[model samples]
Target: MVPLRNQLLLGHAAEALPEVRDSELGDDTYVLDRLEQGRIAWLAGQDAGSKQAFAAADSRLAWEDEQAQYRLSRGLAQAGSLLTNDQTMAYRVPDYERTMLHHYLALNYLQRGDAEGALVEVRRANQVQEQALKTRADEVRAAKAQQEEGGDEQMRQQVSRGMPELDRLIGQVKNGFQNAYTFYFSGVLYEASGDLNDAWVDYQRGYQIAPDNLSLQVALLRLARLRGSPDELRETEKKLGRKAPPLVPSIAKNQGQLVVLFEDGLIPARREFFLPLPIATSGGDFRTFTVAVPYYDNRASDSGPLAVSVGNRHEQTSALVRLEALAAKDLQERLPGMLTRQALRLLSKEQLRRSAAKEGGDVGNILVGIFNTLSERADTRSWLTLPAQASSWQGSLPAGDIRLTLGAGSAMRELPLTIHAGQTTLVWVQRLGNRLTTRVMPL
Candidate 1:
């Protein structure tokens, strides 16, 4: 029941925010509560309050070192067997979803002016990305090895037949696990901490992946000048078609700057899809069967980037990352494992039916078959509370009071901001329809 409620909240986070805020659930009692409370606190501009909630949620979602060792041992123990006979498998959290939590915590730290803490979170997020990629590669290798050893030609053929459509969908994803937004934010933190060398490296990696991103290009140019790299600065300038702006002098002097990060809409949710294939049985008979699969539904959210006005100056936040793309890529990377597990499950059920027919009457076999078919279900779990997309904009503003407006006219909401020179301020905005939640964090 808690899982179902969590799914609902994740699928409709904007709609569910009000109810979650009204609930009496303690922050540490349940994972769902922690997730919801953290999001609510962040949206309400309570950066300090969200720390504990996010920390609790992170600890729960994390894969401990011992857990990985246990999983490895279990895999080795079950190796070379046709089927492990294990009916239930534990839920595996998606890597992108887990990385988002770390990314958000890093933002929370940045809002609180903890550069060192933010760097730690960024490093964790990067480690998660690396692990996810390695795990997927290993899964693909294992699936191929299993297919060769088991001589599951029919299963391999079925997977190949389904590849066309699946590959087409996978190809639509622009990026995978490495998030440009995380890289950009990390570069910002490094720059703020006066680590120009590390900042340049981060900016270079980010720009390599997202060359169209002006913010990254500018950052690279700034670092190039500071590090006395004329060639790199020239390359970046040529890519941008103009000279980049200088680093904020006040920020350099340790006064302060303002950074606005916006989480536009809800990320796409996972939905179940079915694919029917013909399976060859031991009796040389072919049976048409259906298997449940999961895919991303992109039409869930259509919210665009926000137009922000700080005092009288206006700038629109640029798209930094698309969670939908990353989610799709993650699914694609895990496709081999998904196909293998589904095929194995179907084969096990078929064997059960065959055995039941030999041991009992036709009525008993039919009952067993019915139960197996009814119990067949696809794994549809995901971190549903993630935003559809995230965008950011940063600028230098004098230390003083200012009015910030998101959107325009009746659709707009005005919030006050106070900036201090030589420091950093983070303004987070989440928009759902005409409703807006803004938080101002001074660092």
Candidate 2:
């Protein structure tokens, strides 16, 4: 439903605003719509408009984040969903998506040349990440309590364990929510503002999450050596092991660094399918009934690296994080809870069907069953506007007005950039469908 419309409206962001504002806006997806609207506006180079939309989305989410009652209300809301499907429940942003919200908001601020505003959003994102880790246990306990009320834990666990591809993909990351891309970006921001200490901390954390990233490895080494942290330097070098070769030298006093941020394609959307789950009937016999569930393509792909050429000098962007992988991991964490909710919903529907048969006869029961089947929709909702992959190219460039050439596949684009001495210049690039957008920020 939303996924289809999102794909259709992918490149034509500005022209599609009226469609969401006029027809498709729903009470259930207010926050999601706002997020989509913000993304599109940002893509269209409307930073102010994007800021407004993200703010509206955050207003509701901020309330939920501040109030413990709102977290408790999630279970209460599920009670109302028993008669219907999971879509009836209001959309709750996954931990990763919520963090991205602040991350994107920071970008919006940056687009407007508001560093303080961007810093605030970054701080908020960091707070949310910390909060998610702390509250994960409470959330799991709440879900467990709700599951005990209805649904079989054995069946839930079976379903969770059965998705081999999903399990492997989720295992790629430490968890479903934390990503190195955000960490790297945060570090870059802090470093741009001359906060080397905070930048060092963020880079260290990013390296912890993704040890093999060359950019992170170089950042750690460069900082440790520059700031006289020989112990930390040796430790990182040891961690790099045999992989460390052809070492990249630190930027000299006269040269500036070009930090390229490239976002490729769109995040993989969820597909819907009906699954027949086994449950015991009133007579103690097991029966299988169909329930719609959401899934994604778990296969991995290597599209090679983005090539960055400046005159004779050449560099390739390294993968920081894959959004689709993060999405899959997030979905895996959410599956158990989703299955539990589906079980409760199906059990409730069974009682309703029996009541219909008792009161109105076989015809009424058949009609109710048909209605249930028709209304049984999987909640295939997500922040569909996110990029599929995030990558970066970090290297030192001689200070001057330089022509920067960047390419991924068939087409290549060139831009003129001005790099100052002893500073960092960020080149943000996005390839959405046939259109290409680039932003230059000198720090």
Candidate 3:
């Protein structure tokens, strides 16, 4: 049997119930008192009491009017928070009504330096707006159409905003499917507005929704180009079942110097280098070997202030100089012999014991473990000095992207790095604890 209150709560559905027709508690005023008490409790910061009051009040309002009733209640609660005890009583006055009661409440809070409270009210108003706009089926459809049309109009307006290059870029983006194009253009707008993180999310979403679309592809391509690697493109290709672009052969050889030029931007999206490590030494052994170092370069925004890491293209070039170890050794000649032996024993037990007999092969599994450990430390915001070997020594390298971004402009470029003899000149081995746990691998 549906109670009269329940009937009112569910509007017409409950009203039709047999019990509702026979109930003496059908008086609307009694039910409205419960709702008023709830709103009053909420304004007084008694949330639990407010919730109970609200439930009772909700039993009297018709289901069709529930949303509107809630909106009104919300406005009154916000306004009540700003009112003095006397002003609060005035709010209970029957004749004093205002459409934007919540808006006024928010404004009062803001003026009183209660930004957080003001924001809460403002957000409630926005939610109410969304609710009102979405209640009707026809209105929902119309709103969606209007939203799409508005987006299109916004994109067109963006194109005509006087920047020819930006317009061209926008047009190129729009040549793709509608949803993908919209996301891509939105990303561009966010990027131009100095919101790179938001822009990146939009770009990623665009790519995710329509990987093969030209606009998404081109947008990703541009990001990859700016960030400095085709690795993302290649990885994304695998995910999307698309083929990666063919890897180009190296045309130049080592000239002894390896220059790894990275972007100065906040996210450092890509990295590029003209690493000129010599192919072979006088004894025919590779001298300054080169390996491509790949890492995810994320920026907070266009105005990034994070320090970007730039490591040696060849890992063997710099040995870890432990300050404690170095200081002890430097104090006396006798200490050097003991320290060297200790270091070798540690390295042999830790790294060499795990090193395989294979001369050169994939060491991806080991690298993964090492990286995971390092990442864990990083996650804890702890500083760590971990060792890595030359890339050439690792047999199986974990295939990933090496990102690079433009030094000054917007063009981010991505180049593929592999373990092929000509392309990889350097390798780094990971030393876990005191021993080499993995064989050397190219960056």
Candidate 4:
């Protein structure tokens, strides 16, 4: 099961959409089916279909029956009645991936020249982001409160002793679970659709979260100019250290605007790491045990930028988001709960083994201990098909042909694109190493 899951994940990471689409495994696996359909639909430029499919899946998960099933499955897994393997674990919808779905749907609507629909998707994306943030915060708070109320000083000390190691592990990674890229795109869409007020709000929100993002800074400056706020515009210019460019004309007005989105590589995969925990027994002695925990490996893709040419001008794509960082932060945020659960599980197993030793001598104790050890597998399930990173390049040009050159020297390839007046063109490029898949959606 682990190998199969890794294969599917690596396949998507390598942009093997065709192979995933033709697989028979998805017929029985719900997550696999959804992921495969998403890749196929997006790659085929069937945005409407992809949007509907993801929406339907989200609705289904929200249904009462599905909710009950999920709860039961999770309970059984935690109680040690079910295996900790991928198939038995309850599915978790990756928050970042869900947010990206809305972001992509907005692009889809824009491609169809439906500005209102695009706005709706942008609003939905923001809502999802806010909801995810609040939900995670509430869960963490509740967990901490429960621990404080139930645990004694010794237990608290034991937990605290592990903090330094955990902190060190987390410190190696950067960024958080928030999606500044989504906020940035939402701001851009809002501006394009003439909602300058909302555009300013999103731009400011994004900038607050990722202050180093120059593109978002440029967005705020453009909004300031549109709103005729000279003071704010000047403030933005000083911060930017240069004069800002003129606001991009509305793409819906027959102006040619090209937006290239590149989804490069695959997000970091979750792997298990075992940590030795010391549990204090009633005898005033400590029992040394091991618990398995999950962490993200810092493996990233090294795909070069796509050099885009709009007539005589040339620009390379710039990083829009580091998704692996978000993934790492998400795991880091959940570490507290993970540690608590593992500690409880280990304590329970130790109690059981001790009881068996008192009742049935050394032979029974050995058997029970072996059983506990065999059943103590770590939960390694995650949404594994998300992109490693996302990048974008946007420019306004005369209605004509545009050229995109990917790679360099002997491996260089040219992709020609055509744009019409008052049109916004979306060019999606997925790269896995040297392999590239490009699609164009002209709106």
By TM-score, the best candidate is: 2
- Cα lDDT, all candidates: 0.66, 0.77, 0.30, 0.63
Q: lDDT tens digits, residues 329-437, model 1?
A: 7776666666666677677777878888888879878987777656656555555556767777777677777888887223567888777766667777766546555
RMSD in Å for all candidates: 5.0, 3.3, 34.7, 4.9
Estimate the TM-score of every prediction. 0.81, 0.90, 0.18, 0.78
lDDT of candidate 2 over 1-443, digit per residue (tens): 35434643356666666555432333668888888888778877788889988998899887877988877777777787877778888798888888788988988888778887887888788777778778865776777677767686655655555443565445477566777878888888888888888888888877887776778877776676666666776776777663323334553767888899888877767877666667677868876667787888666534456789999998888888877787888776677678788777777888888899899899988988887788788888888878877888788778899999988876478998888888888888887654457888765
Q: Which residue pairs show collisions in model 2?
A: none
Better model by lDDT: candidate 1 vs candidate 4: 1
User: After aligning candidate 4 to the native by TM-score, how far in Å is the CA of 303 from where it should be?
Assistant: 5.1
Instruction: Choose 2 or 4, whichever is better by lDDT.
Output: 2
Q: Largest lDDT belongs to which candidate?
A: 2
lDDT-sorted candidate list, best first: 2, 1, 4, 3
Model 4, span 200-299: residue lDDT tens: 9998877776666656766676667878888988987887776867765564355576777777766666776655666677668887665566666544
Write down the RMSD of candidate 3 (Cα, Å): 34.7
What's the lDDT for candidate 1? 0.66
- Model 1 is weakest, by summed lDDT over 10 consecutive residues, at 78-87
Candidate 1's displacement at residue 208, Å, is: 2.3
Which regions of candidate 1 deviate over 4 angstroms?
1-41, 44-50, 60-63, 72-87, 110-113, 130-138, 144-175, 246-256, 298-300, 408-411
Q: What residue runs in model 2 are displaced by over 4 Å at the alpha carbon?
A: 1-11, 21-26, 68-73, 141-149, 153-165, 168-171, 241-251, 277-279, 284-288
